[model samples]
Target chain A: MSWTMTRKALWDLRWTTFWYALGLALYTLLIAFVYPTFREQSAQFEEIVRNYPEALLRAFGIEPGQGLSSSFGAFMHAEAYGFVWPLVAAIFVIMSGAAAVAQEVERGTAELWLSVPESRPRLLAGKLVALLVGMLAVVGVSVLSLLVAAPLVDAELPADAAAQLGVVLLDFLIAVAGISVLFSSIFSERGKAAALAAAVVLAMYLAWVIAGLSERFEWLRYLSIFTAYRPREALEGSSVSWAGLLALLAIGLGSMLASLAIFRRRDILV
Target chain B: MDSLPIQVNGLTRFYGKTRGVDDLAFTVERGEIFGFLGPNGAGKTTTIRLLMGLIQPTRGSARIFGLDCWRDATAVKSHVGYVPGDARLYEAMTGAQFLDFLAGFRPGIDPARRRMLVERFDVDLSRTIKHLSKGNRQKLALVQAFMHDPPLLILDEPSSGLDPLMQRELLTFLREEQARGKTIFLSSHLLYEVEQVADRVGIIRDGRLVAVATIEELKRQRTRRMEVAFSMPIDLAQLASVDGVQVLQVREGGRWVELGVSDGLPVLLRRLSELPVVDLVYAPPDLDSVFMGYYQRQEAITGERAR
Candidate 1:
């Protein structure tokens, strides 16, 4: 299989991928710029986080006792715009991956594709590579915007902040792509596959937040991808844990392998 | 004929308890046009998928050019071209880009041949496939299948969405390809289309093959229709006594008799000549009727045995 051919296949779905990346970048900027100015005197942000510290903060990754100017900026960039926004951006990436195979089967295009002189695994691998590249492009653009925006906003830029953000985004990308591939194999509808991926991501995110807010739920930390990823610790210039990274890699690879096994055994509906 | 382009032996595929193909066996000799005739749910698509190695068979095996279709799928794929029954294309890509994407996979395809097929099929390469009409999409499929000029072409309902003119053009194209010594395996429900191109046909129903023969042989062994009009009344029982003649209906003051003659049409015609025949119409058996008879026979066999 030619890598150039795989790249060409990626180019076919590039338009939708571009729009999704652009939307994610714009959403990040909006939170970084607009959300802060609006919260200059409002109590809504405080009140929302007070009652549901575990739910609200975990839902949006907002932390309390972080001052308005500095910690608030951190909360916006580190929490909301950092992991939450990428998670949102990853929804599109996952959607693209799910659409790559299941959509073809659903739309009856797999028949046309398989009729050509291409092996089943090679054809499937090409689509998987295309989807992975599309998601990586989105993450690349997000990192570029964050690097450019940090200084102009007068916020303290940690020495390794940009690198730490890159790591977090990479982990999320692999997790999303893997889960998407898994769902794509099982479901014929694009919407259902995407929804299942989102649900899984959200569940993992919530588990991590609970582990962070209370000591009693510390055991649950193992269940969440967030526990394995700590951008704040990384930004403080500490070494990121290898165990969590390995765990994440294992999950991603395991999901992808499961997908491959199922796809090989199951018939193409189209 | 050094090697068969495609061969199958007792191939069976099942989804749970529902059998898609069962004990199916056939062979396509090199440079021959073989037609697979069947109705919907007749295992045509399943057999094609198994041959393409898109799915594995539950039992038996399929071979392409002497290579196992499933085990050596990559090698087999490199030498054959296929057109699926439902020709679906990538909606996001333009026709030109889709063709380009497929062409990139085959290193041996001739660029000149690809261009010629594209032109002959009249597929607009500039437009996105999502926007193309059904006929145009099918044309795009044809261009992809024939562009490579592989040794074997396996097509399932290649003319389903084509108009009459395009269908004729496709027949001409297939004949030309056959002349060039390319084996063709095509499956379709259109009897007339199959009759025009196929040297031999295999009729399948409910995952089983009911009949397989050359076009001429199938029609000859089936039945022929003869309607005779006489200037005067003729005894119907006398016409019925003719060998191979089965009376269907008698009408018009007993002046006309419609008889179905399975074979020995000469004997029936000679017997009719002595009955003061004024006008006569003799017609060979229609392929459609013969094709239907296979299905009816299958239903009767299954239905009666069940009791």
Candidate 2:
């Protein structure tokens, strides 16, 4: 990739990345500090989870009372994965992905960049690299804060819990970013592309949640991108070869490649 | 022998079924400023976009320095610095950051040249792009486009947001650039904007090139106008029978009249001689009228075809 262009994208987006990562880290640290207290009354917390509506528990991918156990990873997953990470990651990547290519054309800056000495593919590749790094940094800071705070509280996270969290988050972030970039490449307006990509992600999450609510609709889990990484499985210290994970990875990477091709041939039309 | 700075052969583009520009052919020689003139939506921008390879031609090709604009765009771009029709940039960037980022893509952009352009344009790089006035933003665009000192400059309405003084500065800059052996393609809807600096002019109308000539040649074309002052009001309809004369204007209760003659001067003069004419003044067509003649003729043909 053109490091010059990649550096430019990163520099321009430095503040955005910093503030978002800082927020994620602060939230993760707060939850981790509180997890030590939950460890003392882990069985009582599981009983509270059992008191929740059966439909809500399924929607969150939580078993009757399994996720909120004494393990630090399970506690973190029980608190964050249910709704927080998916929402935050979707907003971050969708906003960034939409702005990547489509917003440049919409703002008329594509003329300057497109006319520069770099080829279109190289330019796009640089932006995508920046996006990948930016997303990783944001998630990495959040995960690192958990790893750090767990020791401070004299609490232990199962190795499997940490590993599964990485797999699920990485898989989710890649697929969402790829889809968003694909939409960005197609539309000249970022708002339109962002809206549509966000809608698709929202639909997938809703389908996943809906699938968990009923045995009859369990088939809808196949329709959800999150079908691959079960939060319950992750808390239980399982490997990541979960069903459809590869397809999700393929869809994410495939969409990114498709975006590159589309942009290479697209008329900036600014 | 070197190829011309730019050459387009039968260039055309369609936004789906509707044609944007059609069958356009022109060449801008090296070290000359070629004015591309057209009204809004007349496809001037389309031609510029095609030449820049920001958009591909549906048929035909635009080449720069003998390189296919679409296929060898990177090579072609190394020779061009373009100012887009719209000057919107990343609002979050300070002007200095924007230029530095732009410079990062091209190797060996002379720091001296960039500094000179910034000073000449009087742009304040310390300010964020969003805070800059429309004119200052235009100046920023000019600075980046010229700083590279590329052999070719494709400027689409480069003076859009500039004040009159800055516009003059830009024209002077263009001259200096031409002297530096740069070939410039300046697109504008206003004729006078380029009339002062362009070595030649090309007028496009309804996606077609109607005229391509030097400014002097366009003014010195066959179209001529005569102002006649009648001693008193007379029947103006009788003059219509004269071939190759069109009524351009009638004033002062129809006693003072101006008629445009593409030919048939003798027949029109003989007819005018019969009227109660006190005086007549023969005038060569100005650049505006000369270009307007092309526009009106094209409009008439379009009207007729529509009918």
Candidate 3:
């Protein structure tokens, strides 16, 4: 693959990556700073959490016994990794993927791009690799922040669990990013592609939430990509869920291939 | 492989029922500046897009150095540099960054070459594209297309926002490129620019190639309007003797005769000089009038066939 577009994508994303890393780091520190207060009132917090029903506790990705002050991994999941990381990371990937092709077309830059010697597949492959690299950076910062900051607040953070969960989150992000790119290829405008991808992500999250609420909605989980990720399980285990990772990677790769086929055939009319 | 830089045959594209270009056919010889001219929506951009492989032809093919434009577009692009009609570079990037990004793809381009073009265009590299004026942005677009120096340059309305000085500079540069054996496919509605350097021009109208003529041939084919004023009143027969000259109106009692000269201008001028002559006014045919004449001829032929 020609590294031309890959370098451009990385260069274009440098500022975005830096700011996001700093923001997520600050967010992690905020979580760490509040840990002590939760620990000081651990008994009261646990008692109050126990009063809630099992269904409600499961919906929040918290075990009945494991409440606010239980452990750094469980608390981290309930606070940042479970909701915030996925949400922010989805926004980043969705924006990146939508901007990859559709935004260029909409803005008329793709005319200059397509006129060059580089093949369409090579250009797109470069963008895909760049997104994956950005994901690694985001995931790395989130884990490192938790590992270094929690200790400063007199709380012990399991580095291995945080790293393992980061890996699992990265895997899930790849799947979402692939679909986002596919949507970008289908639409002529970036805003429409981003909106559609965000709606799909929201739908999957809702499906997973509904599944968590009751047994009658259990089948929805299988249909949702959120079912592919279980941060509580990923953090609790010694190793990542390899089967789930492999399945998500496959879906991501398949969607990427489809995107290539569609983008290659699509006319750059603007 | 064909030695010609471009060869288009029976190319047609339609947007639903509306024509983009219909049965367009032409070729650009190596080292020649071929001016592709048409009024807006007459399919100039569409035909260029077809040649660039940015869009597919609905009917036929455009080949560059023998490579099919659509099927082997990537390979075809390797030999071409392009400036889009309505240029929109990355609005977020500075001029330097945009140049670097494009240069990264074309490894053969040297740093000195880009610097030379930047100086030639007189654009600041530090400022973002959105901050630049429209003419400056067009200059940046020109720099990028010319910096790589591909064998063929396909420019669609390249002089859209340029002032007169820059326009002259561009025409001079095109001549220099032609001297170096680079083939240029210049598409525009501006007759002055094309008339300056085009070795030949192809006129497209209603998505069809109406005429392909050298500068000399086009000038010869266009009707010249002549006005003559005699020392005294003369009869219509005095101006009507020349077979090629038709009296439009016998103004001032035939002293000032408005005549349309379609052929043998030398004969008409010789005949006019022999008159009791006072003053004469002649209007040389501009490209616009030439184009209108061709369209009117087509309409007349169509009208006859309809009858």
The DockQ-derived docking category for candidate 1 is: medium
Q: Candidate 2: DockQ?
A: 0.78
TM-score of each: 0.86, 0.88, 0.88
Number of the top candidate by DockQ? 2
lDDT by residue for model 3 over A40-140, one digit each (tens)? 88789788887898767666656555565466666677777777778888899899888888998998888998988878888888988888888889878
Residue-level lDDT tens digits of model 1 in A155-185: 5556476676667667767777788888988
Among residues 3 or more apart in sequence or in different chains, the pairs in candidate 2 whose N, CA or C atoms overlap within 3 Å are none
lDDT by residue for model 2 (B41-110), tens? 8899999888888888899899999999999898899999999887778788899999998998887989
Off by over 4 Å in 2: A65-67, A158-164, A213-217, A231-238, A242-247, B222-246, B251-253, B256-288, B295-307
Q: In candidate 2 chain B, where is summed lDDT lowest over 10 consecutive residues?
A: B284-293
Q: What is the lDDT of residue A53 in candidate 2?
A: 91
Q: What is every candidate's alpha-carbon RMSD to the true fold?
A: 4.3, 4.3, 4.0
lDDT tens per residue, model 3, B1-307? 4567999999999887988999988999999999998888889999999999988888988999999898999998889989999899988899999998888888888778788889987889999998999899999999999998888999999998999899999999999999998999999997767888999999887798989999777666666677888988876675677765668777776677788776767777777677787988887555556764565567669999999
Interface RMSD for each predicted structure: 2.1, 1.0, 0.8
Error of 1 at B8 (Å): 0.6
Chain B only, TM-score of each candidate: 0.81, 0.81, 0.83
Q: Please provide, for model 1 over B19-99, each residue's C-alpha lDDT reduced to its tens digit, 9 standing for 90 to 100.
A: 898998889888899989888889999999999888899999999989998878778887788888878777878998888
Estimate candidate 3's alpha-carbon lDDT, on a 0 to 1 scale.
0.83
By lDDT, highest first, what's the ranking? 3, 2, 1
